[model samples]
Target: MSVTPRTHVRTTALVLPAVLAAALGACSSFDQGTRGIADALTLYRPEVVQGNFVSKEQVAALQPGMTRLQVRDILGTPLVTSVFHQNRWDYIFTMKRQGVEPQRYRLTAYFEGDTLARFDGDDMPSEAEFVQRISRERKVKVPPLQATEDQLAKFPVTPGAEPASSDKGAAPSGAQPALSYPPLEPAR
Candidate 1:
């Protein structure tokens, strides 16, 4: 039965290092865990919509001999037009929405002189189809629109107004009598 000071020192030296290493490891692991949590909680990415949108209907309306003014009227201003290629007009549309695949469309118009000679590009979605594609489906829980009798009872009746009637045609109890307003303009 003996305890040496040297042996105590040796034990402490080994155990201290082991404890310190474990504490350091735990702290690093905790740091990593917090990083993972931050990653899981994503930031909001705004939808990016760029360029003029040309719909299938608008494209369908294009004619081989339409004037440049007519083409401009139908499709709005072209997104890309180069001085080098004054006869050509390019329409490009791209949409980036969260939780949905990005959408892109392109349309090119070729003109001979002031008249539109031809037009072509990627098949454009109809307005409805485009709306559907860009829309993100969400399971929104809409609260009930109509209030219950208990909720209605929370509001006090107005002075000089009749209490709410059960009659289907009667106005709500707290409603004030309608007042006539002067015509927006003197009677024509």
Candidate 2:
């Protein structure tokens, strides 16, 4: 049986589209499979920290009758400020670190006529406690609060009298002179 030019053309036309479709489908599926494997094998996922991080010290500083601005200064701008609840401000913080359970904290501040009436939330961790927690979760050792006696002995002890200054005319060691510059022209 002789295969004519017309027959050859028809066969090629029919098989080309099917081959192309299969190749495209396989490429997409292969990419998806590889993506899944890559996701599973990923070792370093960037930690996600969202919203205002209010520490125990800041929360403890909060006092009743303080203005909204004062509360805002202590704890950064609330994450959830609802239009419906104008007087209520919600500060929510979420931290998601790879290989560790997510941590979430929420604090709701109720205002009565522009004054902070009350605040309700979880017992916040102090700065030191928070650092220790993070270090523990990350499998890192927390440094000792006080230096060892041997380490402290390495440094020379200072006398009660102040250190002699080489140049009396020069500014004090820790003093910083105020800087001033001319203001720029206002934009038109």
Candidate 3:
């Protein structure tokens, strides 16, 4: 059968995508098993912090024969508590940061009667260590907390100062004397 221009166009259109697909497939093989597109385009994975973060300090503070209330005060609250296991309190912490390896910790506190019998769990990091572990090492230079003199100079403080009159060398119309204020900081 003689092919018309329309048929030729249709044939080309169909073959073009197949050829492109094959080309793309071959290109992907050369990616060395790396995530080609996904690596280039970043997806936002939120910083997920789930469950109770029981620090070493908090865990250290827990003592045998401590009351449940006392344990709660030190460790905040248990993440998991089972009705079947009424005497056991589990503090599970999981932190999934973007670049850092995900962290999971479990601390189980066993209670005898109303007092803590014993507790055991993974090695918990200190509050400072936890902070460092979760924090991203950004090269940001944080500005000083104390303001510079120049910055303070911009807003010249005049206690109860009135607006200047338009007329030259004229006493500010209906202007009252400046009222003094107590020092911002109390005397040491």
Best by TM-score: 2
Q: Compute the lDDT for candidate 2.
A: 0.87
- Residue pairs with backbone overlap in model 2: none
Clashing pairs in 1: none
Per-residue accuracy of model 1 over 68-107 as CA lDDT, tens digit each: 9999999999999999999999999999987779888999
- lDDT (C-alpha) at residue 141 in model 3: 56
TM-score, model 3 to reference:
0.56
Model 2: residues >4 Å from true position, as ranges?
1-5, 21-25, 28-40, 132-188
How many clashes (backbone atoms < 3 Å, residues ≥3 apart in a chain or on different chains) does model 1 have? 0
lDDT of 2 by residue, 141-185 (tens): 557799889998997678764566888777766778769756698
| Candidate 3 C-alpha lDDT tens digits along 1-188 | 89999999999999999999999998978675667777888899888889999989998898999999999999988889999999999999899998779889999999999999999999999987887776767545567699889998998969988766688777676857669978999999
Pick the lDDT winner: 1
User: Once superposed on the true structure, which residue ranges of model 3 sit more than 4 Å away at CA?
Assistant: 1-35, 137-188
RMSD of each: 14.2, 8.5, 13.4
Ranking by TM-score: 2, 1, 3
Q: What TM-score fits each model?
A: 0.56, 0.62, 0.56
